[model samples]
Target chain A: MLSEFRNPISFARRSTANRRTVALIAGLVATLALAGCHKKVKAAPPPPPPAPSAPAPTASITATPDTITVGQSTVLSWHTTDATSASIEGLGPVPTSGTRTVSPTESTDFNLTATGDGGTANATAHVTVNTAPAAPMAESNLTEQQFEENVKPVFFDFDSYSIRPDAQSVVAQDASFLNQHPNVNVVIGGYCDDRGSIEYNLALGENRANAAKQALVNAGVSPNRLRTVSYGKEKQFCTEENESCWQQNRRAQFTMDQ
Target chain B: MMNGKKQPLYLLLLVCFLLLVITPALRAQDWVHTGTNLGVQHIRVAVASFKPLNNNAQTLPLKSIFDQTLFNDLKNAGIFDMVSPSMIPPEMPGSPSEIHLNLWSAAPANAAMVVFGNIAANNGQITVQGFLFDAKNPTTPQILGKQYSDLANDEATRMIAHRFADEIISRLGGGINGICETHIYFVSNRTGHKEIWVMDYDGQDAHQITHLGDVALSPRVSPDNTRIAFSALGRDGWAIRMYSLTLHRLVYFRAPVGNSFSPAWTSDGTKLAFSASGPSGNNEIYTIGANGGDLHRITAFRGPDVSPVWNPKTNSQIAWVSGRTGLPQIYIMNSDGSGIQRMTDGGYAVSPSWSPSGQFLAFAWNRHYGPGVLGGQDIYVMDIASKRWIEVTHGAGNNDFPSWSPDTRHIVFQRDNQIWTMLSDGTDQQQLTHIGQNIMPNWSWK
Candidate 1:
């Protein structure tokens, strides 16, 4: 049925029909005015107007701000005087008269259609989203290998989670990085020197990780952005029996994730 | 020849002397090994070289393997004083027709018992016939005669000899069946990563069982000799994994989210107990059915509890290590987590292995160890009846994870980087695995 109606007619016919209706309405108004003068009518709650032949439904949409920077939102408002159901093309059905906040990634045209006893009416609202310059460091999940490299391990004294005087500076540096890249979260892994039971090492590792995470928070990193997991003695960075190797294992490590 | 009365007295004196001499000989004939005497002195035995019945190219080689394996088994039985082959006469006898017990009991080879066997290798198969005899009482019946046939290979030959040797040990070395046929499961890192491996009790035919390219540790072979329970690191963190020895595959266990490891099985092979990091941040002991269901938490101490071992005799008691006392110590509790008792007073102790008889627990402890103490790790055996204990490995490199043999007379443990076995009394320490860093050995139940 829609295909039978040719193109250019939908817009042209609507305009032409609207003009002819206005002229007829002007003539009707003159006649009505004369009747009012003759009858001295007391405007008794005027009888309701007759239903239109094709239920002339109406719709309108407007974007509060036609364009927005990426990640910013824009409010779209729509109102239809005579319509039962109304929906926007890009969005599903919405109330006949209301407003909605939209955050589109690109320029998009939203067509609102209202249908009721009246025929359908359409309107469009264009929302343009501009991409903000790429975040200095794009927010992406770190690869396991990348995590291994970017996160510098923090060493501890023998059987100690207390940050050494020298180690304090290292942690502060880590805090600085975290502050700059607030979008990245980190898991602070605790470790041991492989001298205790695997279970004991696990708890000790937890203490170390918690200690490092606390230090980070103390240095102004968000606590929720840091996670703590104790590897215990299960994973080792060194295998030698010397103090050097043992020192390497007795520490907390920083690993990042998106 | 003299006076009549005097001649009668002389005849009675002569008859009494002969009767006294012959009675002891008759008693000696009836004295045989009935598996009753379990004395300190070793039972001397002789193993004659097997007769090669056919020239199947493998007959000579197989015979040599059988002879050596059987001889070593008896010698290692600890109850035997084996006669050296060089001491036996050059004449080799395999069957009953070719044997003479008198020769074994002779001067140089004073073996109280003798074992002789025959070997025959036919198309891709070999048959071994073994016979044990009492050399002391030649007129007595044969002690044991076993016939075994299998694929004609070095492995089959050694296995055949082990079976024959076990039968002899059972008949002559007391009531316990020798562990010649048993295998010990352990963790080896020679393959670059720790893997579960199996080897004969003597460390022969060592083969990798689980190729789980990760660090698999604390291997405990089940009672039925069909499965192994070990802990490995995986995507789920540390999990207690089960490997089917019979099916030669990994079986699933009802795993917990926290760090789970160190699985132990009940004597009846129906339950497994393990340690997992509990929600409270401390590792606690938990138990589940063998088929991987019906979980029950057995311990909820403030400190870490791990390495559970079930009493093989009662199947009602479990021994494990708990860190509730600051340092890790051994503890025992009933199957339902009742009747909790502390076994070790102080110092670091771990890896408790309950004896098959349910009489003792073999474990590694560092009693005199302190912050800087080196070479303090030693294996100890404590009788449950009395809190008394004896050290097994001393001054040896950090011994741990001692497992009891099926006979309950021997213990296999890890010393430093190798697997070693010794008598329950800590006498004859023999290294089982040498090429790889092996640890956490668990003797099979059978």
Candidate 2:
């Protein structure tokens, strides 16, 4: 072992082998053997242990199917290197590497922090939560649907709130439907064609709605089950500037009300 | 690195050099005081951009808002021939010592009046020092100097600017009060419901006033500006409703016998005149106390009579629309429904709004209103004494519901689906709303 330590110095003197070169090689070998003897003598006292140093912890996270609808959920998978503990932002302490199912009501960012003796590392995974479209009424509850299908809207003539003969029959049918469904309350929305002044049209539309309600009251339907509101020419059902479109807009629409 | 270190010093030196060079030249120049008296002729005014006094994050933005609002208010004052910003000197004079009369009174600017100010913000508060100068006078150029301090916010900054502009207007535009501080209440369907909404007279900072998820129309603010009298559709059908602005909730207004529409507040704020149908199914003009009692029928006409408006100047007369003849026409009568006089000779006149001065009546008139008549509804201002009317809007998408400004110099009306304002002589027309269908704008009394 002592000769092994002196091989580097002897190789340097291989080209020149004079007395000085031989003397230098012998000196280096003697010094190396003495250092080896000194190391062996020191080994018994237990040499100081090397200082412990750790590198920074690495962390990475991913969310599978990051985008989900309102009722759906997403999975967040994470992995960490050289971390003693790890935790997500919303969730408490978890394993160093694991998967978690998260269902956030809104858009959220999940942050993961991994801590170790060396350092702390962070990784973030963004999950986009989209609000689902408004759910339709339940299949068993068909009050609104029945109102739309059975309670027909009665049309009016130009500048006239008087229910026409044809509109009379339609109003009668509507009243009959309301009488049949006594549990349902209905709001009669009076609308007008996009003509005339807003204030005047509001008054005219109210007159039409009241006339319709009066007809229903005359037909055995309780007046308490009916309410009237005038839309006037404000919210138009048809925007086309034509006679047919105006006729379609000038009507008393029936709607289910709470 | 060396240049960056000395840059501020260089800037200071340059500023010193400019002041030394400009101050003596300004002092030595001839100062001519051009006499432009108010009410005689339009004064030529120059509005310099407000100087930002500091580098705070809120300073520049607040200054910009103040600058724009003040400029627009002065431009819309209807009595000033405003100088173009390009013609005026680029230098903004923040104080009396900084203003140069020769620079403003000379060639390109040729302004008789100059308005300048400086704005600063620190520690959540803003300070504004505004000045109006007679640009012609060198020794005594200051016309009006005012200072305002308020919370550091866009709204407060805007209000400070408005107050400053009103002061300038009141000083320069004869004795008429500025309408900049007024509000315009109208109907907007922006929130998917026709709710009453209010905004500044120049149409800024619009917000909903009522959360009644139904149709509300004809918002007439009380003379005191404490409540709004309007008609809303509710469970009992169309009824006149009162909303207390200070209370931020609906107050009680007893419904008359039939459906009530178009509630018009008297200038005294004691009563509201409206039109409602009776048992005969014909709408008639009716008056009720502001506290919702003492309902009385003012008109017992045979045909439909609706849309009543009290003469604000003299609360003894009212102008309303009557269909007693073949078509609707504007009529003026006494408060007790006597002394009936037809204002329009022919052709569909409705929605009469008496001017604050009681000299003119602004109404929506379709002179050629007939089948295939080839004309649309337009707004007209009529001299009540001579019945001589001037058409304010021509062929602009069926304009209607013209409400006179409190100043009597401007009119707000609904054209198509948006609310608009223009001078009484049909100039400087501006579209106020762009979001949704807005209609029936009523100017505040104050």
Q: lDDT of each structure?
A: 0.80, 0.84
Off by over 4 Å in 2: A1-154, A162-190, A209-231, A234-237, A251-258, B1-40, B372-374
Please provide, for model 2 over A1-258, each residue's C-alpha lDDT reduced to its tens digit, 9 standing for 90 to 100.
323433543463344347657878999999999999999987786344233677788999999898887767899999988788899998989988889898888999999999987899999999998896333533237567777988899888766676788887888888887776666788888889877787777767776777788888888889888877777786799999888998998888888877
Against the native complex, each candidate's DockQ, computed on alpha carbons, is 0.02, 0.09
Write down the TM-score of model 1's second chain: 0.89
Candidate 1 CAPRI assessment class: incorrect
* Backbone clash tally (model 2): 0
TM-score of chain B of each: 0.89, 0.90
Interface root mean square deviation per prediction: 24.0, 31.8
B1-446 in candidate 1: lDDT tens per residue? 48787988898999999999987764444213212124578888888998999888889988888889999898888788889888996777879889877888997999898889799999999999989998878777488888999999999999999999899889876688889999999889889998999999988999998888867878888888888888887643568888887777987666654667788889898998888766555667888898877888878765667788899899888999876645578999997899999998666788899999898999998774444556458888888988767776767678888899999878998887789998887877899887968877889987
